[model samples]
Target: MSKVRIYTLAKELNLENARMLEILDGLGVSYKSVSSTIEEDTVELIKQIVAEEGTGSADGEAQAAAPAESQATQSQATQSQDAPEQQETPQAAQASATAVQTRDDVAPASKAEIPHRAPVVTIMGHVDHGKTSLLDYIRKTKVAAKEAGGITQHVGAFEAQTSKGKIVFIDTPGHEAFTTIRARGANVADIAIIVIAADDSLMPQTREAIAHAQAAKVPMIIAINKMDLPQANADKVKTDLTQLNLVPEEYGGDLIVVPVSARTGEGVEDLLEYISLNAELEDLRADPNGQFSGVVIEGKVDKQSGVLATVMVQEGTLHVGDFLVVGENYGKIKAMMDSAGGRIKEAGPSTPVQILGFSEVPTSGEKVSSAKNEHAARDLIASRASDRRDAEGAQVLRKLTLEDMMGPLTTVRTVNLILRADTQGSVEAIQGILARKESEDVKINVMLSGIGAPTEGDVLLASTAEATILCFSVTAPGSVTKIADNKGVDIKSFRIIYELIDEVDRLMKGNVEPVFEEKYLGRAEVRMVIKHPRFGNIAGSYVTDGSLKRNAKAKVTRGKETVYEGTLVGLKRLKDDVREVQTGYECGINLDWDGAEIGDIIEASEMVEVEVA
Candidate 1:
């Protein structure tokens, strides 16, 4: 057999481990395993094995030993020190040396470190269900007590530092507030603390809260509150909760049910502990180094300040003086205050803070961002507003298409119609008909449709939705009409639906001309009243500045204001009926009223025309 050595065997292989085994088995190398502390006898044995293999001559060994002579004398003696030809085999020696080095490089296994984050808890229930009170109890503050009424008026975010960590609580004023705040609670919070009044069991708000939380896909903790009340029933509350798909932790489910009394501070600590434990299992974490982003919980115009907005920082840090663009508004953060009213220089991820210095009040649930500067913030806000306007315009245009009116339409074209009716049934019927009307170009969108006289809110909603106000057998209040006129919102009243529908159709067909009537400022003298044979009495009056047409709608003016608005039932030129009555012309005008006196001036005017909307 050919003489074999470990280094020679190593040089003839591809894989490192295979090379090591080839050298060991082929050379018949029988030696003790190399320990951490090398023994001199073991080294000698390895040298003897290499020598016995005798793959090279003495002069080749001399050349191999010569290269290591200056570094180590013992290694030089073991290496080939004979012919200069042996120096070419050092690459094989290096490979064998690498294999030996790896044997000593073994390390123990390690575990990965887990990240941590603040717990996000949401307080939810029906209105007046003690959700706010329970949150106040857990937070050890008087947030609910300080509100306008005993109930919370808005969505409030607070942070409570417990023994485990910090727990962020979002207090929404029942399910309506939750839906109003971005239409869902899942978007706002991670865990939901459903507060149910023990005495009431399962109320409408309670079911709404559960539906919202489940829709959000968040874990729920049932807080059976009002245990201090004499009529409280804990078991009934639990059963009701179970009916809403909330199985308690004790009943083979993960949900925790804690009985508490927001009025008496009972079981508050236990509730907090349960939340903390749930958060631990969830392993919630946020990247604090990311860009500052959060949702606007609520906003309002301050009497002292310009626009005050409450924001919940979901990630990164928001500092005071940072330029922020919230929805359509932009401003530098003049001040940052926490829930406790303490001034904060900076707010990290999950911290809810009230900020001052916005130009306008951003809508609740609008995402807020920290820009680089005021100019940048303004540009970003303007860009976002432009984008939103474009999107809304496109949506409106799409809704006016045949495809939008077809079967199984996903997007509904809603034109907010502020309906004011004389009676409740009238309002309901008008709304129902308008809602069912099939239109390829335009559909009715009623935001605030009520039965009473048109109020300021109706005008505001009309202005906001760019919609028209439809009054059925009712009139708009003076203040509301003035506001609508100022805002350029069309307000139309109809005694007949067919006429209104026909007018709307004509308007939609682009054939209807808008009729604008001059306001009847106050009438001059009623002049004289004459009794007629066939018709009723006529008020012969002189023309004011504007021409009064026959059958035109007019208001009966007495002093300086209008008393009644009706059609000019009769316009006769000295017993002869005329179609047109001009200014500076004497005409016999028969008003549509029985109580028209001599002093009561017959003011002629037409109804302000609005495009069918």
Candidate 2:
């Protein structure tokens, strides 16, 4: 007969290896280790012993059952049928109440103290900066190759086991379009690993990642990637990071910096070790037997599987058949799968698992709590809806603009906007201008901002949020416009900075007439540049479409990205300076900035006042 491994037999019996070994020792059976092999007869003996013990325990529980205890459990089950609000009290109160409850009680043994689980780390950085690459190396999966254009468009949660300990990583998209997704990652993570490319140093997305982590108030660890490249400069990256208040520990700052090469798996072990150490210091703990709670990482509706939501267990264990109340939606867990896509009966804290049972897709970051049953779940959802209505009723109705608030009693009106620009700098500049327009009566709420033309997804989001889409130097395609129109979403495009600001100003004033517009003047393409001794780097270019004039408002573009938007400081032809250079003519242009590069396009336009009927 073939010998069976002790660990394999333990798994078949649904027992821990350690517990199996203890049973063997108690039965006077010899064993070497979990990997040691045993005769078939020995396996049978172990199984028999376990079965006998389980049966004995069951018999004892039956004998110990009393009429009074049974009545008490029945009474508690009746109390649970009351309004869900009474059951959703503070965590401490629930824990204390559950501590005395028996298995016969209607509620599961939640609130029981659980051991420390793995730390969840959020990986965030700039696009093409190796955020996914690092996670791919750690997880030994080719997730980057599977992504469209090698850019992660959605949030992904993965679990990896290192020599030090196990860690759960939230791989947030590095592109600026997924700001909300990245923020959700940071909000639920125990730590944030801000991945910065060594060659690129710092980019706009990197700054945004850092800001999100800071806003979440989580400890951050810097991983300087691409260290294998010859042009990689880790020191320069560190120096730039200090400007953002992220001083490295070596430089007397609290931040920890690790130089890593995702291509070669260099410094990866050190990074994992640092994460383990940090998690130890934080003393992360949860009660697997405590009240079940989780956060919705992401959710989607699958045709075959129904509604699937990736939930990270925050407090207790989530089990199959457990009733869950997520936001205003509730469902019983029909099935559960771990990060590895394997079916799991239960998941503990820090474990990311996809659960099937939600009636509808719950928004990301919604709190997930276990319910007693389907009836309780429905009650919870209805109660939450009622509370929301009551809260709205208590607040004064918001007016459209400041002019509508003429009485002594007034309420602030919120104007929600979705901003899309051609570049990150344009988004920042427009946001700065909008910030100055906010007052007590008019509050500006930017729902989302990104760099690119608006897409169908943007339209759907605006439709759900009831927000206006503002495009700055970017336009929506015909298909996107059609969707926006069908969804009844307003889309506004602007070519000049002041024109956009002026429209927003009017919107806040309850009067949007006499709209300010920009007149299209000319456009110039930089053919070459000369480093003049006095003017720094001058862009010598030909007028591609229109004319360039001195003191005319100009915007520089590199490919599809806007580099700068300001007035042209100087425009000259050969030696003498000229006021305007028309199409087919070459001119040397001097701008306030020196970032002019070859193939950059300089667009000239002036803000003009106009009226639209």
Candidate 3:
């Protein structure tokens, strides 16, 4: 046969030419290095040679080329037969061949199977800061118009078909529920649209939403809303966002800042387009074959339907008749409905669907899963329920402070508290008063307390915390009240401190009787020395407000300080121990202060009443 040339045959067929050359050298086959681009043809010739050598299929001309394949195969077989001598080489060559074939198969399929799903966008910001309004504007929906006072009351996710594509928007009360969802690290958003009022700039909930987005590491787009307002200043808002490290896209950064007016529908289209562009850049995708997983957006018990829940499917497919376990409830999927209220048999990845057939309402933000069967679902639900109870019990045990140990032992009774005030200080003062109530069984926890109006956060926290919200000198946004009713979180508002305290005390005591108390009126700065028998020397003072009555209880305070506290032994105008001293008048006050001195501030007051046990 014309010179075996196994290396040349290997090169023509694009085989492992180097390995073939090594085998040929080992087998003592002769070959010459030829200048040619015939590697593919050489590999084919080698295949024919191997087949002809085995089955005698090739005639004389083909047989001449057959020895290369026969020799290479025989060489490889011999290497394998040689055992320890060529063991590593043959195994390495076989592994290379297998890897090359696998790579060739996997590479083409991966590129062809790129995912294309709808972008999930969560609308987040301060309560009533125009988050719902902006979503309504972009979706061309009238959610705000239907709401009692242009406010969204519940967590809702819907899809809006835009010129670019279908965009999914989750509209939750831009308050506590949003934070709770993000805290679990199950961010259902490909992009977070932070809605900020142009006139209001940054507020508490705005800051909280920004923190939540950052914690979830979700890309954010700042929507400077209410631009149509007379007080709206978009530039000021941009500056505020920059301070929070959200530099705008135009400022040579990635954050897209869209100025829009939800009331007037200005720049909403541009906002939608930006969202689509961000989603495109992210290439957000989810695997359809993975196990079904989703976060509960909203859930409730319908008098007619039993239990209803809305869930956003993050992965896999959920079908009708699929058993699901959600929080404490388990159910067979009776029906699946899309956001538009259209009944569907199945929902794939990135779809938000309202499901029916749950035995009990699942809590918002809880994860929902598809189980194998009813028995598995029931078992999983029961297990989860026990786990939750154990966890909550442990948390309650951990929350037991020293106050709980020494507090009055009373039966546990759920008390709903609604809290509101004009300033942070007053709100804190009232909340502190309620929170410090001494009761072992009855815990005085605040459901929600904040400055300004009764927000959606107050209502949601109240619902989840199982406590009535107390508002002081603050009005409830009409929509918030409606949501509170819908969510079953009781709320009450008050303008006076005593009235609020009285109601809370009555609730804790299971009675409507008002508790009485003596009030402190004035404080005095000691300016001169005075005489006293029990204590060596007293001090002359000026009444700051109201009147300091003689023999009344008083507390001594120095420059921005409290030194001593006792009953006022005597109070005198000039030389007489007067019954009382009013404002703008100087008097000699003999306190129980052991070390009386000049320049001491004495606050005169009395203990008229104590909290009844």
Candidate 4:
């Protein structure tokens, strides 16, 4: 006969090993440790005994209902116990019977196998893609109208009750700066809704959102908004999505594409129906009685209140007065408010609530877990701090570079380098020469090219990105070099631009095998347009990433389509001519393409050869 270990039995019965051992002792069973095995007969006997003991109190009311009938039932139960055939019920059947009992009736159980909960959905897409608008229509609120520039700046969590069921929606920002925030939202969500503009199809940010959702491994639902517009083209949106491997259900794939008008509340009901059906098929569930844990969706310091944190409880129920250890901080929950701003004493799994008791503003995406008491919370915090200190002391930071590779390898296709020069003009000239050195198989990426001596910040960035620092007509301070040496970052100084270009060319072809590809410089968003008489349409833009270069090959992207592609003619800061504009700075850009409008993105790139290992 097969035998089961005592510890395994304890786990199946949801009882502590120590408690199980005590019970075994009381029942006169031979068990040395939790690891000891019990025969199949003994296991069944133990299960039956435990089941009887568990339901003894719960059956008291029934026993009192009719004494004669109860006595008769007891006699029958005793008779059934003696019958070998009656005792032949499968172990699984007995376990199922035990699960039907409540936690109050059965002691030491961890969680319950019960009803499934609603799914948590995250809405993500490109800028001005109507993500917030769809959510606003669903929740019957003007959340989109309240934001400046009609764009969401941060992540917002809210619960919506639809005809299908309730869904917790996390509306993430569409801007490029909040890429991390969007990924965090997807990580905590069960399903992701990729909102696409029906007229515009898919933009760069929309593709980024799709990538984030795919990385998180969550099911995606495409929501094509703005269907009420005359220019709305759902078919085009679907065709574009197929290029990203998101085939629609109507096309015989599993993906569901819903075309809806956020302004008129069209096809939203069908979207919710599909979401609810998907959740049902997925069988998404959580044990509310399990250990309380959650993820912080967003955290911020409020001037009126203290640290306000929006957390989505993943498991168990959170009650008022419960002490929580959020990231490195710990505090007792003073108050809890639901998505609708209503005060709540308790919150269960899949519920998003704004809590007001964190010691400090916890970082977004930090795990939130409950501690047994205030002392436990403090102890956890102290232990975490000590662990971090020990790890930092023992950790050796090293950034892997092409020079680090040994022997012959064919994996390195691109070289990541940081460029620093004495002047902007020198930096531009060196970049221009490097751009020409690119081949079909090799490409060089200037991750950071700025005008100044290489500083500690540049060294740190190089170390983190595993990029070599190239200085033209500029030097790195001794302290910065020391730090770079310690971090295994390379700092190469060159007096001439040709020397830097030759080094890159050697690394690309001579030192390593190679090919040339398009090197993306940066992206800028057109905030305003100046209709200059002689200069034509001048795009007043803010650099969002990297740096916008003057006289670089640029493209004006209107939504998913590129409207214009040509060289940028005029790059200026106010009236003064500038060779480049860095991130966070506003400048005037004049390209041969005059179709650049407010909200359109301008991308700058150069052709360069990259090494192929």
**Candidate topping TM-score:** 4
Q: Give, for candidate 4, the lowest lDDT window spanning 10 residues.
A: 175-184
Writing each residue's lDDT as its tens digit, candidate 4 over 151-201 gives: 222336777776556888876544221334332342577888889999999
Error of 4 at 613 (Å): 11
Question: How would you encode candidate 3's per-residue C-alpha lDDT over 294-383 as one tens digit per residue?
Answer: 888888876776778899998778999998887667788999877766678998888889888887777777787888898888888788
Off by over 4 Å in 2: 1-114, 141-155, 175-186, 398-613
lDDT of 1 by residue, 1-613 (tens): 2334332233333223333444455656552211012234533554565565555666678887867675687555556565446664668989977876465343323212323568777788877879777776776642322434332223367777776678888765554444445432226677888888888887745655675565456777888899999999998877666654566654545467889999888888777767776675465766555567888888888677667888888877899889987667788888988876667799887788888888788777677778888788778878988999999898777634434233234554444455677887876776667656747655654444455677664554455445567777888878878988987888888899676666455533433345354654323346787877766777878776667777777777778877778888877787688887776788887876656667766666555754433
Between candidates 2 and 4, the TM-score winner: 4
Model 4: CA > 4 A from native? 1-76, 79-112, 141-155, 175-186, 397-613
User: After aligning candidate 3 to the native by TM-score, how far in Å is the CA of 38 from where it should be?
Assistant: 47
Local accuracy of candidate 2 as per-residue lDDT tens digits, 476-538? 999999988887888999999899887787666645434467878989888898999988989
Best by lDDT: 2
User: What are the lDDT scores of the predictions, listed in order?
Assistant: 0.66, 0.78, 0.71, 0.77
| Candidate 3 lDDT score at position 335 | 90
Model 4 TM-score (2 dp): 0.50
Backbone clashes for every candidate come to 15, 7, 23, 17
